[model samples]
Target: MEHIEPVISVKGLSFRYRMSETVILNDISFDIFPGELVGIVGASGSGKSTLCLCLKGLIPHAIHGEMNGDIWVLGQNTREVPTEKLAVDVGMVFQDPESQIIGLTVIEDLAFGPENLEHPPEEILNRMLPILDKVKLQGFLNRETYKMSGGQKQRLAIANALMMQPKVLILDEPTSELDPIGKEEVYSTILELKKNGVTVVLVDHAIEEMAEIADRILVIEEGKLKYDDTPKNHFQSPEKFLEKGWLRIPQIAEALHALKGKDLLSEKYVTPFEEEAISTLSAWLGRESNVQFTVD
Candidate 1:
């Protein structure tokens, strides 16, 4: 087997704001490989956003604070590299889409990053064409940026980041403020990015959505690294998380777990989606055909 290098690596990372005794992050360490979609979850104030800032070279560079340990992005130390340079390889989308927008129109917004990089107009147009389509905003080129729906604004923010052609994209609660339809729009774009091989680190409270798309889930609790495992494993014992208010289990997994507690399920099953739940339940029912069952 070939060894693949991690696109992002953090070693013994710890941090706290200057003049503050409270530690925002404590001895956190992890590696994210190429083309992986990893979800970071925890209760609010778990330092998830701070971690995102660290990954993007904002913590030690732009934000003033005491920092320990090292973070390497594409093998370059984030501490050593300038944030502007890091922005080329690492893109970030914040909780509010409007915060990242700077252009009056969609095209202007998309061109902002590359334009600053001094790319020619023709080259900028070339870059925007494909990304516009990727985010499903090709038809909204001339549209006013402020007039877009919540979902559209978020997609535009994503496309703007893609204009930089970053190798790693970190999204912090991108769907928190959106309607259901808006959330789905952002989710679809994220899945599309994964398919295209862009490594993503997402911080979100939508556990069910994360279960569906995340290759691995990293749970943080009170400035500590709690769990780093696949969705199935991380969510298998939802009680442990629910009891502490760390995360919400996917509905299917929660239901399956409840059934298992009553001995109705012969084995523990963690289902993140309806289709998988259907298949697993059908198989179990087939084996229990001889046993009579009553539905309350």
Candidate 2:
């Protein structure tokens, strides 16, 4: 079998702000392969955002900080490469959509990155048109960005990032401030991106969303990496995460765990999706009492 190289690699990474004595990130390390959607979860002040910055080459370069260890994205050392150069390969969407939004209109915002890179007008249009449709903002091309809703702005932020044609994208709490509909809109966009083979690194407190979409999950605690495992494994033992105040397991997993404790569910059955959970439970119940249960 041939080995696949990771698109992003971090080794013994550590950092402390210039004037601060406290270490913001302890010796952290991980690898992200191409076309993977990795979710990062942690309590507030746990250095999740800091790690995103590092992946984007913002740490120790744009931010004043003392750092140790190395992070390589697409074979380029983050410390050695300028952020502008890194931006071409790794695009990042911040917690606040407004912070990254620079253009007055949707078209201008989507074109900003490529425009700065001096892409030809025709090439920029080719890139922008498809991304606008991909992000479901095709009709908002001439709309004033400031007048858009929260979800529209978030999707716009993602569309803007996509304009760079980056291979890897990192999002820091991209849906944190949106309403339920808005959150769903952003989540749909993320799933679409993953389906199209974009490597995504997402940091968010939306544990349910992570469970539903992430290929793998990383748990960060107090500037240290505590857990890196599949969502099924992490949520299988909800107590472990709940005990440490790290995450809330998806509701389906929570119910399944309780059923398993009562010896009503087999250890082999573990999932975060409601439809899967319902099917598993319905089959088990039917075998026990000839009951027929179906999802509506």
Candidate 3:
């Protein structure tokens, strides 16, 4: 079977601001399939945002930068395509939801994209309503954007981006400012997008949450791709990754790391939170004869 072309492809990518000598991204390369939900995780200055910016043609076009590489989004070479043109192919949601809102009312903001394409006004109306429903922001259509809560604002941001009907969506720390409920809402929205066949590239430091949603995880440290693997493997062997000191591991995994020497604990290392709790209870219940506790 022939392989279908990727939605986003990067090769030999490197970038540096005109004012700075340091390169933010090294010779990085990767590809995103049509419907895969991938997460890029790293420290503050690890170039997660920079790499994401490049996917949407924001690095060299919007920001003055020395860029050396090739990036293709929706089959168009990012280097040759204008940012405004790429906007139709790839949509981006930044860390701050407030920065994305523009029009006074939610419906108008959502309508902005299709209208620009000179789509028939009725057709724009047809597209806008469903997107509003998809994001569950229909009630806010006539309401003022400023009056909405932070979570509502973020959903509005997503609604606006979806209004464009882009094939790829790039989100940077999308849930960083959201509360627990808000974060869960955003994650559910992402899963919905994936189900609708949208390619999602999520950049955030929440490894556990990302692991639950992402099909693959790419680790970037000091502006380079360090480790790219399945979330299960990354967490299953904590010490191995900790030795690299690049990727972030879950807290439970870290606890398991420190318990490696406690023969019984090491024998049944847990993966997820529920698994850990059950394992601990089983060991303490005296179900296993070899299990024993000691004080140092």
Candidate 4:
């Protein structure tokens, strides 16, 4: 792989709510490259959301916190840049869709960010269609925000963030409140955003979906950056994370892991996706019953 330059870099970052408060992040540091979809998971109150806030310059700036170390986003120091300026480069969507949705109409919601930055009407209009298409909200541009379903509202919130065309997008538990179908819609949109070279930081409990979408996983434990590796490796060593009381790999991957590198299956199956695991098992069994196993 070619050396991709990091778009965001954190140097020895640590933060706490106040002098008397316990540290939420403890000397955490990492680099996020352009177009990378990074997934963060941990037990609740492990400083995951605080990390997101730090990335977007909310730490020690808008939110009063005792912060140490530096964060550089888009080649600019986040500590130096104003929150308004950082907002332009890093688009953030909170866990709750309703909290972010301010406009009565979809068009108004989508245009909210741009209008704040004082983007002209024509320029905003030109950007609308493309963004609407990106999130699959094309025909509902004029629909009422409250009338939309949980999924639609979530996508609309994402669309609102995309209106700025920010370099980085951070989402906190985007699908926590959505139904299964709503989760699928939001997950699909996240995958599409990765394809478009948008750096995304997702804090979610959907480990299965993370296996499908995240290029790399960042596991946090007690306000520390514990594991940073490809999802493949992360799932392969579930025992380590489990021992630390961090997170478990997807169920599908756990099933495959039990059979991985075993002669019982013709192929060494270690994927986390459900459909892929099923297919791999079927093919292996077919090879055993029908004919001799031939290496692909």
Which has the higher TM-score value, candidate number 3 or candidate number 4? 4
Model 2 over residues 1-296: C-alpha lDDT tens digits? 98999999999999998899999899999999999999999888999999998999999799988899999999999999999889998999988898899999998888888988899989998888878887678788899999998778888888888888778999999887778776777788889889989999999888887888999999998899989999888887777876776577787888887877787776556578766777788777675433354422
Tens digit of per-residue lDDT, candidate 3, span 76-176:
99889999999987899977889889889987777788888888888887888877786667766799988988878888888788878778999989887
**Candidate 1 has which clashing residue pairs, if any?**
none
- Give me candidate 2's TM-score against the actual structure: 0.91
Q: Which candidate, 2 or 3, has the higher TM-score?
A: 2
Provide TM-scores for the models: 0.90, 0.91, 0.85, 0.87
lDDT of 3 at 253: 67
lDDT (C-alpha, whole model) for all candidates:
0.87, 0.86, 0.81, 0.84
The CA-based lDDT of model 4 is what? 0.84
Task: Return the candidate ranking by lDDT, descending.
Answer: 1, 2, 4, 3
Query: Compared with the true structure, what per-residue lDDT tens digits does model 4 show for residues 135-172?
Result: 77889978999999887888888888888888899998
lDDT of 4 at 139: 92
Which rank order by TM-score, best down to worst? 2, 1, 4, 3
